[model samples]
Target: MKNVNYINESKEVFDVIVIGSGITGGWAAKEFCEKGFKTLMVERGRVVEHRKDYIAEGKGPWDFPNRTKVDNLLVEEQYKIQKQCYAFHDGTKHFFGNDRDLPYNTKKGTEFSWIRANQLGGKSLLWHRQSYRLSDFDFAANKADGHGNDWPIRYKDLAPWYDYVEKFVGISGNYDNLPQLPNSQFLPPFEMNAPERAFSQQMASDFPDKPVIISRCAHLTEPQKIHVELGRMKCMARNECQKGCSFGAYFSTQSTTLPAAARTGNLHIAPNSVVESLIYDEATNRLKGVRVIDNDNLSQREYFGKLVFLCASTIGSTQILLNSKTNKFKNGLANSSGVLGKYLMDHNYNARTTADIDGFEDEYYIGRRPASLYVPNFHYEPTRYHKNFIRGYALAGGAYREDWQSYGYTDGLGINFKEKLMHPGQWKIGLQAQGEMLANRDNQMTLHATKKDKWGIPQIQFDVSWSDNEKRMMESSVEVASKMFEKAGFKNIQGQATERPPGIAIHEVGTARMGRDAKDSVLNGYNQSHDIPNLFVTDGASFASSAVVNPSLTFMALTARAVDYAVKEVKNRRL
Candidate 1:
């Protein structure tokens, strides 16, 4: 809620500058501020205060003029790309960026939906909140398949950081002891309804390799002293989280990290300051500062910092790096490896299946449970290799009886329909597959040559597509899901093997990957730029591959770990 205008303050160099205010940015700011560094967090969007700025929170469907639906005219004009996302609606549309304002081009035959949320909290306030830890299977995946750069740091290096982040964020889930999906330091898991329990039992019996459990989420199931000190409480199970949780029940930059960072007093937030590029000092062989563009006034300014952390989203960070060109680095800053905008990846999650349960009419859930059921990747082990595909996919779903609202689609007379509406319908179950997308060099994003945005930054152009492996994996997902539904004795089973174009999953990663060799990658194991020692990129841009899981948790772990390394290197004068 505290906005600091750096332009009015003395032009003194800060200890650290974090160029983003999203998930990783928030973490970086908190870590840096708590370490007693004078940290400045530069956010391109408007400041959104926790609880106070959630304009749509707690609003019911009937509260809106058009119910929960966004106007068709607005969608056609400003939200053509954003509307493709599943979360975009009347209540949450304010969080999404307008496609018309943030225009980008795609290849002739391929399409990449660049979903963006530019606000104080960024996508952290709008994410699905599903948090899962990546395993050695993901770390060793690139080496095993020779797809992308081999991850320099394995699961062991990140496990402790994951625990640290999970403890602070208050993840809620049970420990299943699955190697593929490591357990987090969690609060108690939410209870499942009768239908979900039955589905889990059937899945365990029929598909022993695939274990169904409660999906891990960043919700305060049981608020601890740390949470209470931050003015947060336990989740109320309202499930209208995308609108923002006024109760601070969910894990978001506004709800958690922003407040923690603010409490440190070393934190300084500069909102509406869009980063144009980094300022490189050839003499010092380091980044001197950052060039910032005022989002509204179109005026330019520069802020100096000893260390720079690029916590912007994958594409956002890449764009800033590519624009920060110097005489020594003709192509881009820290892009001597020529792999900056290549190896782009996203999760393939279009394939899905649904079925109707015969019974459970009497059963009903009390409140809106935010988390879903999760089935870990069964084909993650080396022994369980797919002939058609190299990687695996995870399944997220749940079973619930249809409520009275579902009666709108049923055929009935007035009296009969009124009577039937009193009773809930049969339980229905669904499973959506989230397959790992291989890191492909051709699936790239670059800046448009001729086009520039309002702030004089080049428009991003995307050329990404799904390969045969992804298509085959999607087919397998539908087939396996249908088989599971059939084995579970469900009726009217339906499945889909289709895959949406890249970026629909909102899990876009890679572009500036990490590896041991600087020739093939942009960053090192510590997320430090191979070319610029004092610069760090701790967001998804440093991912070597897009593992089959929601990536926010992994991003947080990587950011925390990178912060520790950066701080140590700075103190030791190694950077």
Candidate 2:
């Protein structure tokens, strides 16, 4: 990175300070800087330059000492929580936070896996990349069911932002035209294999309402002028994205927004700056600045800005807000509503079902497809009295021919074994459920009375857990998925539920949620804090509900939109 971009020990007050350089942070920085605002993006970890820092992108299995599997001892000691993530392995372990260094507790008898990727890029380097837009179905879900506070803004409010962000991010998806999952500004969608096409063909006959479509994602299927201008290329279908995509094929902090922000010459980056709290000015009733701790030396410093945008992932941002207890608002800054760290939510993804296919021996896909097939929510019966669950879930999976990893355990010798490994294993269909967890006040996180991290920041104690509504949703999702495959004439079908905790979904969102009322929510319609004029949170922390689809897309859209609004507000001299 240019030295100009790295602002260390700076006393100059910036136009904007964006905390967390993940999805939303990158967008906030990019949007603010491009709009002629001097922005300082604060990251609590080391800088990861794009292309240069993608250390594991092209390595083969032989390159790893343990054949790309993380060492057991290292995993057992430092990655106990991170190992639960699907993408954690030898190739990608460097991007993940060491569990030993980051400690927090959950309530006894309940578990929430708080996966951390505390690097410059944050979880954007480690996300699944499944991007979907939320409709009125999701925005009004709380109001329709009375489960949680109603979202202050609806789908129409975010649609234009989604269009703006998607055009730059390059989403690859079919315009399925489903009301539940609105279409994006799409690149060409990836093709489904023979069996998946067969499954899609038969789904309409079995379940008429549910839309079975190719999952939307942030991968660049076909590079557009905007993407090409940034040196991004088309998706190679490598699917080794968790290791990092140097090609900039997917939307990530490194791949897209960070570079966009850098080119404008208005963005400053502060790596290894752990935010301790927000400095509140009691007399002015605004945030004076941010209190930061150096990640390595434990030295303390402060960064002042006219506006503060908290894009720190759900838990990280909540910690800052809760820890920033001011004399004016004793609990936390902009936390007068007392809802800063309540209503913690994650997708309930504990249900899974897989089945064997008898034939299609000649059929296969090109280069291990990256995207999955999706079954949109089928059980959202608002008018009628239902029994299984209140909210809904979507199932995502695909049929693929297994490689050596699936059958490598079998005993073999010499050339015969080598020849067998070259051949693909039997085809199989796998599906898993991702359901919405209601925003119950009980599912929450609180600052521990005594426990603090090495930087003297209070550790978040998660009291979040799945309720019966989630369990019922899982059961129903599995049944529907199994029946879909069964009706498709697949053989050796096996369907069962899983006993996994929250955060394994890697989509844990909510804590400082957006709502209509100032008394019950932290953020307003434009992601501005309800109490503080210059404070905004645009990451998943501001999510009112954990909608079934992947949330990174919406997080990006909200961040861009929030920055737009904040810039205008500042120009108008209102903030």
Candidate 3:
């Protein structure tokens, strides 16, 4: 960090301006700067430095003011929407946004949970770290089913980029050669405990079509030279990642991409600068810059750039595009297709089933494991097709023994209860569904007619909801998980659909999708705006469909590839 530059105001026109310093924004900045292009990375929140800023790291539940539970009053007033997140707790509450300050409305009967991490690292600091690569099945799902427009690019277009990013990011997993869920460049995978191994073996014997494997994640199971040089270490399995990882064990903007970007002298960052909208120059038919409002104060400023990449989260990027209206494209900037704010999609993560495993009592595992056991989608395979739903889902679960913490308000007392609590209880297995969501034009988000935020930006209102396809998928998931458990000889299998809102998965994607034609999509194959060449969106907003897996790794690969293409286009003087 010799010449690391952080500024609030800048008038110099940069070669690239990246909006939002989360996962993709960090990669965009790193790619451009390393290519010798002067880049400006803009973040709409306060700076969160890597090791020095993890205030809650290395601390246990006892250190927190409320024993790892966020205060009820604070949650009610400030974290109404964010509280719904699985990672939202007192230990990591600082990473979540104050929902009262970030207000938006849902349509009459629909509900949305727009989980936000408003800081320099964005949600990268708070992500669950499950990294997965979508296959041709996902890319071609929309075209085959006619749910949405066809994706202009396919898996081959992104496989090399996935290898590039995965090696640098240090993904840990086994090479499960499933076509629907492809393998990634990986480190040594974490080991499954005795119970989980038994569970996997039984599932293999019973349901051989659906292979059960260890989940892939961005943990440093074995640090490579690239990761070691970046000051990251093997995962210690603290499992408190939302509070931040000081060892850089998990991939986050603060740990990996930001440091790499800052190592180059050409990188400049503007924190606390909330972009109001993109500055589209009608004369050049290009995105010239952006207009932003300071997060703390109400002062306004402008940033000039030759090219701009919107790496803001799916909703945030779409909000900016929807607000950036011009004379030529009044609907939104680069929204010539009239699909800027339509075709919104999110993963259906609602169905859950838990069962008790009666054996493996003598083998008690000690520490927490970073990843879960995953069962990939098998409905697309021959003889395994479904009737009600078109797309499929993946199941994530693990086998765990009940500890003292698992018992709550027990009615036992004295010596009998104390002796019983000393030993680990029966091995329990829990499975959660991560189903694909169909891209529907009816599930949309639009700018409010009159509502505005504190910074005078139009508030976004979401009308997105689970369609019949998603509901049927979740319902099928419950039955499928219970049947799998029964086949594995697990007892007490209870399965039910938890009808959660659309955005609760926090994997909300699309709303500005990439497609083959200009009339049906917002971006092209290169993630460049169909109507504006100099503008690109490499975030989840550019996804055409919600693939049935974690989408962060795809986001990383696309951003790196987009930057490479954007630079070549610039050298050709195309912009």
Question: What's the distance in Å from true for residue 335, model 3?
Answer: 0.6
lDDT of 3 by residue, 1-575 (tens): 44568987788999999999999999999999999999999899999988888898889878888788888998899999998999998878899888999999999998999999999999999898999999988887777767678999999999999999999999999988888889999899988989889889988888888788999999999998999888999899888788899899999999999889888898998889999999987998988899999999979999999999999999999999999998998998888899988988888998999999988868987678889999998875323558887878989989898888775456678898888888788889998999988888888999999999989999999998888878888899889889888988899999888788988888989989999999899999989998998999999999999888999999999999999999998888877
Q: Would you list the C-alpha lDDT of every candidate in the order shown?
A: 0.90, 0.88, 0.90
> Model 1, stretches more than 4 Å misplaced?
2-10
In model 2, the Cα lDDT at residue 251 comes to 87
The TM-score values for the models, in the order shown, are: 0.98, 0.98, 0.98
Residue-wise C-alpha lDDT for candidate 1, range 362-416, written one tens digit per residue: 6788898989989889888567868878889999988888767777777788888
lDDT of 2 by residue, 330-382 (tens): 88778889888888998888888999987888887788677999998765537
RMSD of 3: 1.2
The TM-score between candidate 1 and the true structure equals 0.98
Residue-pair clashes per candidate: 0, 0, 0
Task: Tell me how candidate 2 scores on lDDT.
Answer: 0.88
Task: Show the colliding residue pairs in model 3.
Answer: none
**How far is 238's C-alpha from truth in model 3 (Å)?**
1.0
Flag regions of model 2 displaced more than 4 Å: 2-4, 384-386, 411-419
The worst-scoring run of ten residues by lDDT in candidate 2 lies at: 378-387
